[model samples]
Target: MDITIEDKFHASCFTLKKEDILKFDKEDNGPINNVLIGIEHHCYGVRFFDDRHGLSVEMFYINGKGLLKGDIIQLQVRDPQYYQLLLRFCVLLADDYKEVNALIAFNTFQNKLRGFLEKRGIFTVTSLELRQFKGQSAVMVSPSPRGIVKIDFINQKEFYVDFFNKIANKPIEKGKEHVYLMVNNDTGLIKIGRSNNPVYRERTLHSKEPSVHRIAMWCCEQNIEKKLHIIFKDKRIRGEWFRLSLADLIEIEKFMDSV
Candidate 1:
């Protein structure tokens, strides 16, 4: 059996109704995918679902971040290659679920897959997956275990640029630093920071058990994150976290997009 790992997730916008944006107006909250990880999850991990030989495929989804929250990371194991399977699932969703409420169906499928993987000693990440009480009294948490691994931004430099360029549908100057926005959906608190490893920072926040939904990440070398922090200091909740309205989000969006 031949297998390949996609180095990066395709960072693209998902379509949703205006009603959705209003409902989820907690500042650029994810924008929705087919059968998403959670109600406000930003990162959507999509890949194959095999029946012949169940391979080890894992991605971190902590509540409103990747998958769902809790000890179990609920997600859909979809094989888009199999149109029949997708069609069957869609039909089932429409027939069984109310108004094709895909969350129930997709969650079921993902949970079932997780069960299968568990039985086979394969693991994807949930909130509690990386946590462990070691030895006497220390609690050690790994943000990206092998199961829910982090993207290597340094090594795969070109891929990063290419992915962003594709998202913009225009060429971007390869940047030396990245400024990102992460939101805590539960509290409606947003974090604006600069980090080379934004994903790692996100998972670290996940360890604290906030619904961290990654809003957007932009590559820039300047101290823009700092500048934004100072600009929005009045709106600051604490530290890097700011209480931003949708309009403020748009302003920040304009700034990031400019870079």
Candidate 2:
């Protein structure tokens, strides 16, 4: 199956297929180009090409680690406008598929693409966003409508405040601090921390530890990390590290909702 989005200026299309998905395990031929793994959704494979006209993206499902056996969709966007709408559509699709929890980017453009998604109420995790190619870091995102709405209202009051903050390297407001929970999907270990700039923090953490995989962050006004640490003191394996438990995860989600 295929879906296309076009306007007078450009055209974009997506193709879906039911085929053997690529595995990134050690046995496979070098990793698929620009692979993005989603905990809830399947995985994505992205490729970029440019010519005299402009830039284009070829996106597809690279693996089925978490999804049921069915048709996987591949997307192609020709330019910026098409790319933007296509990504919004992708988020809608992701919302429908619980398995998709992250979007993968291979190149600079895709990194920016994921950033755009992040601004639209979709949050990202550091562990799930991987950069196969040695270049700039990839932006890994998860959906958080509350966070998105908050950011949207902030941007409206002060246009591009988020974007400028990143570029200008401004300090994140102490009052706007967010407490984040990072989970290692492979080992099932969790880390609790706080940051005003979660994305930058994720990039730094990814650079320091390649093993970290899935992350969940929630914004709060209070110092919740210390409180959480005390609450899970018995389960603490080390500094800010704890054994995985459903109770803790549930509590964390509930805290996010309250704050």
Candidate 3:
């Protein structure tokens, strides 16, 4: 089988014999599978099959023009383990194309990729949703292992900083306190408070009420406790405590998005 991969940089042709395809199939204990390859062009297709029954063939089409401006290479693998293997294969084949390796790394291991990008002053925002609130555009960034974070800043760098701060669990700076929403594990009650020292505050709350746990915290400049108190006045069970409800939680999220 002959395979050709053409990109903006160069054109290369690769040939795989019937024995080689059989070897791979035998090792994986599966028939030749189809894998999707994507780059700048839309018509490219890649396929694999056995040749003994007049079916053995592996073909990939690559445009000779190479990568142009705004070109991104994408690969889709259905199997998780195969995804990793294909990524490694791509890295080897596209050894000179740094962007190809980067795209694979980002899609395969997003958390690790984000960490790497952040160290080098590059950031990616995923699951971003924009909403119109109070006649203003509100941007909501949903980072994994954390709740949605809303910020009013339009600057990309500042937005990345705010998003990173939340995901990293870094301490809130003085005068840049956070409005935390916690829940009592035993009683299922919600607690809202402001704190610059969240760790200490969480410890203190646990000491006072051993069954309480910090659920989520939002970084905000203003005193959010006051506004939250007024909004959930009816649901308030006691000082800084409210009866947790689905409606109240949705309202809380909306409030966060607005700020």
Candidate 4:
């Protein structure tokens, strides 16, 4: 588990790829491994995955502008000592789940472990697993009766803002808005599209053509829970509409199937 740690002042020193870029695409799921230069410095790395297209990773803090370079960059994994300690701690807590004193031990260890995972890009699960539990506590660490709890992204600051905006339906404005959205409560294919005039089109058009309903239907037929949420996207530009590709839909279905 010993992993190398790379340190440099600029991103030119690191490699970037479609796999890495997808991994860091903040639009789908907040990238995993918000790697920082040091304990206090900003994150230089993030990870993304697309089962259909493959993985994409990115370095968000490359010399400040956040540009992707073609050079190959190595990700630092957790050290053997750290991982062993974590696995042992998890085993202990799992064994003591019913004990009253377990709460104290669990909280202490869980916090420490979470920080450890975030630091080294080694969580109890992958970004997919983390996203499955986006707002609630980790089921692996902290069991829940519902079994379907939102992931706890308190540490992932980006998650909260998008969650809030979706709940509020606050005007996303007319621009190039990047959104990773899902539909759960509604029992049909949920359409995902962007409208240059969202106010007129989304509000007025209800024909269901080119809608996400088809995607939702496929998920439903497969017995997938339709829990939809939006991930963030860049909106610097405006007045263009985009819809999820059929291939992307297939990827979504696969992600749903795994969960």
Candidate 5:
């Protein structure tokens, strides 16, 4: 199956130029940038990134064909942090077929993803949006701090469930300030920032289109937060948001504790 179309994709990912990838489908939400792709043998591997390196998912395997007869599409997620996101996305492709060899259920997972990223006004969570929008449910997707996180939105629930599940340190007692890491559901960016009140900052950033939720917080001074910015300057995509991975995030938390 031909995974990529000539004009469909902007260009090869060697340049790491976001403009190289066509963004006709989505203008804001449900978009990706700086994609790196490769193929080894029959395996198609890709890395999706934001601005920061840590926030990216690399070596995502979209198997070319099935095991024996080129049937049963396979999606392999190597990154531990993004397993939930990949799993959820792959589930949809799986649902449409019991066993499809010709197109391997949908040409390939890459096609499904390219369509999701490039198509205009296509809701990956069709059923969820149908119920929410048609039902006139204005209830925005809110991420819970603890306990079982109710699935509100696709990306929203993934980060909360995966990132907040650990609940690293206890909540910031009842006192001082702290640097916070907020996750944006739509853009897939993590904001490493601070505020007099992290909760208030989160409220200011929260929204329906591009949802923002504070996933982690550290009890540290503003200076310490600045230190983090310097340390991860390479990952800094913009002001406070950094393309951070799970390990990078963990290291930030540990640094906060040490300081």
Candidate 6:
């Protein structure tokens, strides 16, 4: 239950036990690695770019067994942002167990995970591609905004139901522009205005729309509402959509204030 990679080109080696392998698998339960073991026998080796650092080809292995001695497998690694993108892509592109298993397997065989990503409007980065930039750091820049957000009335409704269910400490309803920090199903952060375009802003949260900062984006995406509550704006926040519940509106207002 261990996977090892002999970095033939770089002359480095990596090893991990089954538990560690499983941990990575839990992070992404795709067959790209798992199938490498059950079929190809050894985790396939990939040479990838860590965009966080300038372009260097690093070696990674998918764990299994049976890779032919001296056989070479090419691979790529993108920044952590790409990792989140892949998670969502895998779910969207492969909705069932079989489709998921197949595509994950195919992605390994094609050795073009980078190219595949780029075609989908997701720019792939290499250390070399990054090194060309000025004053680069390991920090990630968000992707361009999609301008579309899937507001979960269910979650919003539940928030209101739970809020009014309380005997005391009832949230006050007010006529003001209230903004809240909301997270999409993708765990992307957004500043939802009681009136502005929450969906559109959510899309740009990654790329350019600039209302919320990095910390606020991180907080909401992590589903930690309590920490977000203290940042409520005591002032009137305005936007176009104003019929939202008091609790939900206030929660959003607090988050906006915090930001």
Tell me which residue pairs clash in candidate 5: 25-118, 25-119, 25-120, 52-243, 54-244, 54-245, 55-243, 55-244, 55-245
Residue-wise C-alpha lDDT for candidate 2, range 67-167, written one tens digit per residue? 43322223433333444554444443344443332221222235544554454444543322333433866443445633321111011112122312322
Quality of model 3 by C-alpha lDDT = 0.46
- List TM-scores for all candidates, in order: 0.34, 0.33, 0.35, 0.22, 0.43, 0.22
Predicted candidate 6 versus true structure: per-residue lDDT over 1-259, tens digit per residue: 5322322322322344555455555644364454534654444333434353333332234434343122222233323333333333333322322112222433443344444334444444553345556586656564733221111112322333254342112232333222334423222222333313333444566465333221112212323433333333222133311222234445654554465
Whole-model alpha-carbon lDDT for candidate 4: 0.32
lDDT of each: 0.46, 0.47, 0.46, 0.32, 0.46, 0.35
* Candidate 3 local lDDT, 1-259, one digit each (tens): 5432334113223433444434443543222322112223312223433222222112222222343211222332222233343334444433433223222232334343334334433334443223335457665444443332221112222222353344325555666688887666545567888887766798898899886666567788656778988988976888998764434566777888799
Best by TM-score: 5
Better of 2 and 5 by TM-score: 5
Between the candidate structures 2 and 6, which one is better when assessed by lDDT? Answer: 2
Error of 5 at 169 (Å): 11
Q: Higher-TM-score candidate among 5 and 6? A: 5
Error of 6 at 113 (Å): 4.1
For 168-217, candidate 1 gives per-residue lDDT tens digits of 22233443567777666555566788777666766797888656755567
Clashes of each: 2, 9, 6, 37, 9, 28
Cα deviation of 39 in candidate 4 (Å)? 44
* Candidate 2: segments with Cα more than 4 A from true spot: 1-175
